[model samples]
Target: MAKITNETKRYPTDLTDEEWTLIQPFLPKVARRGCRPQADLREVLNALRYLARSGGGWRMLPHDFPPWQTVYW
Candidate 1:
């Protein structure tokens, strides 16, 4: 797994190190010929989990997350 640079959990929705390792391989990765992904995959998942758990609108996501558009897409 790529090292998770931000280890501190800022919210209840963030992933733990063990959980991140198990899930990381399943997430889509950056294409070899395209621009690299702009947002961190782990953060995106955390934002998604927060949305699911809280039943919040995409726009309502906390600022610490990637933009709503990014997560929505």
Candidate 2:
């Protein structure tokens, strides 16, 4: 595997493949299946960071993280 580069370095929001792989084991097994598949961990974490760094309410997070309402409260 290639070494981590500046652009690929983990931020408070980003996750590397290996990190994702480790977490994959714990991902919830949901009941929904689409014709396509998606894993949006980065999107959600980034949203979380936006809230954390900005000191904004979690409801201020982008719609990408749908649990934002509960997160805020």
Candidate 3:
């Protein structure tokens, strides 16, 4: 498994290495022809977990998360 290098802050809902390894295969591969994604999937997933756990509006997501729109889409 690749090392998670950009994890700036730990969140309760953030997936551990084992969890991410298990779920990684189910996520779609990045498209090579289109513009590359700006954020990592792990970051996106963490943002999602934060949203789900906090029951907060998209616009209210903490700054540590990716932009709310990124996670929403």
Clashes of each: 0, 0, 0
- Residue-level lDDT of model 3, residues 1-73, one tens digit each, is 2355337347788777777888999999989798988888988898898889989899998887789899999
Q: 1-73, model 2: which lDDT tens digit per residue?
A: 2233447654455455666657657865545765332435444545566677778776566554536754443
Question: Cα deviation of 9 in candidate 2 (Å)?
Answer: 8.2
Could you list the CA RMSD of all candidates, in the order they appear? 2.5, 5.9, 2.9
lDDT of 3: 0.81
Q: By TM-score, is 1 or 2 better?
A: 1
Error of 2 at 22 (Å): 0.2
lDDT of each: 0.83, 0.54, 0.81
TM-score of candidate 2 against the unseen true structure? 0.42
Deviation of model 3 at 62, angstroms? 0.9
TM-score of 1: 0.85
TM-score of each: 0.85, 0.42, 0.84
The all-Cα superposition gives candidate 1 an RMSD in Å to the true structure of: 2.5
Instruction: State which candidate has the highest lDDT.
Output: 1
Report how far off residue 6 is in candidate 3 (Å): 14
- What's the distance in Å from true for residue 48, model 1? 0.2
